[model samples]
Target: MENLELSEGKEGLPYNLLAEKLVLGSILTIPQAIVLASEKLPIEAFYLQSHQIIYKALLLLYAEGKTIDYINLITWLQDNGLLMQIGGTQVLLDLLSQLNQSSNLEEYIALIYEKYIRRALIKLGEEMIESGYLTKIPLETIFTKLERKFFLIAEEKPMKYLVSVEEGLHQILQEIEEGLKLPQVPGLKTTFTDFDFMIQGFQKSDLVIIAGRPSMGKTAFAFTIARNVARNHGMGVIFFSLEMTRQQLLYRLLASEVEIPNTRLRSSKIKRTEWIKINAIINNLSELKFYIDDTPNLSIGEIKLKIKTLGIELSKQIGLVVIDYLQLLEGLKSTDNRVQEISKITRALKKLARELNLPIIVLSQLSRNVESRINKRPMLSDLRESGCISFSLTERTFESILSTRNSILSWNGSSLIREKITHFRITGRKPTYKVQTSLGWSLLISSHHKILTKKGWKRIDKLTLADLICFKLILLSHNKFSITWDKILKITYQDLVPVYDLEISQFSNYLTNHLIIHNSIEQDADIVIMLYRDEYYNKNTVEKDIIEIIVAKHRNGPVGSTKLKFDPKYLRFFNLKDSMKIV
Candidate 1:
């Protein structure tokens, strides 16, 4: 027939017309064949446009629970005005002429699929050739674009199949038995005792989504987890970083590993003894199974391809795959609407996890609504858009300023003066408390906001410590001011409401012989883990060196939180080491 061109004159292009016709013909004869055949092959698997049209009509009718006979197919095609364009009813009737009741439908489906892949490859090659000739485009951009296209094709290879319940149970029993013999629980452990015990570690084929505001130590958590598995258990880690470079990642990882300051490593400040330690660590770490891909704006398809290809190339099984925040990742194709694209991305990543059977950690940004009063800690509602670059926590320097009106007394190096009140704002809503002092002075603030101390700044939460650090405050009495150290008598939790903030002008700061505390603060965040550090909100906070890991979601276990000691000087998060303590 004129409609069934049969790939004639299209010499080099591969497609089997007979296989396509027979598959369509089988569906026409046995309507139920569409069920299995539809799952195995898409309509595009057919060679001719006429067969594709027929297949599309068959799928629609089958989905609607209508009989897939010649009359219905013809009626639907005619109703949709696709009859003549597909060469009318005669074309579909011709497909039925090639039916063989005994033909293995599986064999023919595979055959047509092989041809479809060939056609796809040929199209890909032609597009790549065209792209190569566009001298205006950067070589790197062209290669990445071509690479993503090829991987998307390669990733489409997983076909649907049915497994018996008995088969699934057998695999589960075997894993459960093996798990009992292990020293620790199943899944890779992060060595955080309470934390690891809570989740039973990162399980295989699990899509663990970690989301937080920016600069929240998400990357540090990823590195620490990867290091724990690779160094301790020898399990390989593949980090697909859409942000940060390979050098920067490796540099920070190394710096964190050895407890060396990143600046010290970057600058020419390494001591002779430290050089010995660094060289030894380099020698030790070179053998570990840690891989990093810092390519930015990678799509889910490209990431899957790289991980799969690398797993094959090195023959090393990847235990964990980490994507450094999802906001930076792209969808399969460019789309103007981000919500739809992110939804698509989320589905692809989940599918990749199951197909690869690897524990995947994807970092997402929280929405700006997370900073609002009603929702102090990140709630599930805040994650509807699924994570964030916006919404910073407002760090109010002193409730002492909020205690008074218009202006507050400050030591401007010369003498006590009224630093003009530049601005007053309701920063954010959190679990606030009124800290009552022994000297009849009370200030309302969040529990973790730091106050000036003799040794350093201390959070209001730890005022219960027996050996209290001397807390200083400026007292005003009838236009006369006196600087004196104050101790908190009691901290009473207040209802969730707007936290007041005040900004002072003319560069006024309280200073002592040994320490100085500034007026205002700024915070930033970054990722394996969705962590919230109070210090980011309060720059001079005692918890500044303490990171709180909020398990926003856990597929295998309950959601919870745990703490880690952070060292800003070394840019590392660790347990209670001998030398490290929170200020």
Candidate 2:
């Protein structure tokens, strides 16, 4: 790790002149050495202008599949009319005479590469100093540029290659055996049972697309997955929100985690009791290793640089990356046609995912054409500026969608649901419900009723007192409004009696709802129960706000739809089971 010091001399900069000569001379003496030297050193490695020119000529000969001996080198340079510029035949003869042995070719190449990196650093330092003097440029921007330059220099490691197929196969088999012993093979899980099952958890080096129309809960869904990976699994997460500010994103996360309406938090309207709960939630969340970058109009290069910086700073690998929405990203190069630019952006993101060996969930917007169609569900064609499917879909499903010219009409209820299906074919059982219409969507319904009650009632399975309390707590925390004990009792009775074919009177022996409500702490019950009562009592005045999460594309999983109950008041999302826990 010797530093190549810069010397103040007439020659200008410090460089290993002997090393460059040895590299070129060895290549001339043994033409095969050119291949090895070329892999290690680029033409830029030569500091001397004449040496650079000679290396360029050698590259031209190498590329043309010509021999690189002294005769061919001189002939090529002369034929190209550039022999005299580099000191003519005498220079070539001098280099040939200086050739010692090809054994030290690697050392010469390394020395040249080391000098090249040092020169690059020096140049970078000058640029940074000049940039710092500019008042117009932001300090962070200048630092980012310098960081990228440093990263490029540091990333210049020697090229690697497999020695033999047998060695590669041996490594592969060992990895497979090691993977077999793990319980789940160690990957970032989405925390969704079926979805994780299909995708086998977000594998390393995967680019996942979660596309939908505006206000489709893409951000919420992505946040949920990010939260699970960071909080539950203790893995690091980096979320880049192009549309929303970092504070706004944090507000959403707080609302979801604290189970308090985001409106209340934003307005500073939380009650004393609720504030206590919020404090506890915040304490829990503080333990998570999550990072957020709300930089608008980020280029792929900047994203890479930021990721590298975070990985180094945190000393931990980033498990997941969520880009709030893709359409807002600026490409490396601007183009008049937005579609081509977006295509380039996606391709770069895919490469980044593989390079970083982490799953990148890129949120995307469906085209407005979806609104014009009979069915609003998104198809692959609706992906804004989509070029091709980057991952595999079922062959039959893909072909069916491709062959069918007419829009597919399917039944979800009495209403005929029309879907503008274009890329994926429908397989398996016919969809019972079209919960999500924006992308590859399907819904699942459950019929099993397993209630937890403390006291075993006659004709209906009963739950212990503890079971009842647990159920009540779950119900109270899941919704936005407080519920009366009477409502809880009625809902529980309805859930149990119908399945057991028992009459309502069979549960009359239990304490009345009024008595139970009086015993339970009023603060423990939120407004969600009251909202539920209002829904039935004053249906004409009830307002409902719902967010749909559509699985547009899953690289290693099935594409489908899953619904979560969203309470805009709390800015929270709850699973159907918890939302309807009593029922």
Candidate 3:
């Protein structure tokens, strides 16, 4: 009989034929040993082909409820016509002879499984090398695929023993005792107080599903929680925004933090004052442990691999994992049924959450059927796969309106201007401000703080109509025009608000007398612009843009609804009380 090779490898590869023989021999020696060995070692785990055939025979006998002794094994192999191919009954006898005792079956299984994993790693490395030589696929794609394969191998955990009821009760008692002393939610707290109160923050190993129809603030809500966990808790976050690019997601985050309109930021219509806020926010944002991976068409395996890599790089376990809108994720394999694919994806995500011991927030889109319903609030069934804790957002009102009724000097000052103003009323279906006439031209300065009073005008500290006019002049000047007091005085009344009776000198006098100033408007232009934009330009009416964060399913807590003030201008969600403070 041919002896099994103890050491088998070429070019530093890994294989152990002795471990495979010991595993099979132990099962043959003690027929019941196949039960434990099969759990750890599959048929393919055997290094030698002959041992693989022998193990297959043993499994067949075990499956058929037949004894896995040498006689039954030989008969099974002969019946299957694999006896001679596997070196016949002599090889089976040699396997039984090699078994010193079946007591070390687990150890033998462990050795065989370790060798199998090592071989898998070697194969993966070879595939990676071969893939690098191929020019058709991008190097990033190859790296991601290979890295996921490697991580999947590395993250495999051995089967754990089932806990007894007594042990489980002890653990529960301990947890209850600890809970009484702490009483605080164990996971990261969201910035929104009401939402956090409803869900008790995001729990570990929980798969949180945030679903909404198209144009709903699903991504915004996920981002809000991710930002809060990373910034406030100082925990690492891995946000996989498959729908948007990293730069686009960062822009939204910046807009939310600086309270700048996303549209204005995207259009490069930012004021000089807003730039200062951006600079300050960027400095702080740089310190946050927020990582974004915008890999389009990402699979659950790829997300897991990226999270593992990021956790290692950040030197801390990630507190949260966010996948923007689940429908965008590609499955491992294509299937005829999309619902089945989604079900597999969601199950994989849930498994990943438990494996990583972190909260995973996956955004999903509600079905089109949701739109046809009278109450558009999404239900648990609205989720594509409909598993895991889901939170749906139904827009109770229209998008928030941030209106700035500015009066431009029309060259043709006909009744057409009034007609244009009347036409502008249809744009935003909210309240309209009264038109004011100045210098035979309609002057409507939409100031958040500017109030026309009996004493000419009551200008707040730095946010005055004159200051705002100077800020706009600096913005429109594009740093080409030097900002001087005279220049500001001219732009404030001459261009921005051309009052017929009030002279430039009178406007300058009004600013100097009423507005408190330590530095020139030019010196404070950036801060003034940021303050003005944050207060007025990016403001949202709660009555118009109401985003409801409905907790449709909660594993450890009660299910309910929580309303957050959604600011479409900034693409952000805020707690109602906090938003009122901002207003």
In the range 326-353, model 3's lDDT, one tens digit per residue, is 7789875665435436656776788788
The alpha-carbon lDDT assigned to residue 210 of candidate 1 equals 74
TM-score of each: 0.67, 0.58, 0.60
**lDDT score for residue 502 of model 3:** 12
Give Cα-based local distance difference scores for all models: 0.67, 0.58, 0.59
Best-to-worst lDDT order:
1, 3, 2
List candidate 1 stretches off by more than 4 Å: 1-12, 158-160, 308-313, 384-529, 538-546, 574-583
The residue-level lDDT of candidate 1 at 526 comes to 13
For residues 1-583, what per-residue lDDT tens digits would candidate 2 score against the true structure?
2333443325355588777777788888888987897778888889887898899878767754577888888887788788988988898888988846666667667778877888888888889889978999889878766765676676676666427989989998997898899757256776655445445677777777776666656777778889888976787899999999999988988887777777778999988888788899889888899999999978777888888889899888788888877788876564544543565677678768877988887877765655566555555445644322111112333343345453332222122234443333222232111111122222111122122133321111222222332112212333332322211221111111111110111111111111110010111111100111122223463324534344434534455545456665544555543222110
Report how far off residue 213 is in candidate 2 (Å).
Answer: 4.2
User: At residue 35, what lDDT does model 2 achieve?
Assistant: 85
Clashes of each: 15, 25, 2
What's the lDDT for candidate 2?
0.58
Q: What does the lDDT come to for candidate 3?
A: 0.59
Question: Weakest 10 consecutive residues, lDDT, candidate 2?
Answer: 520-529
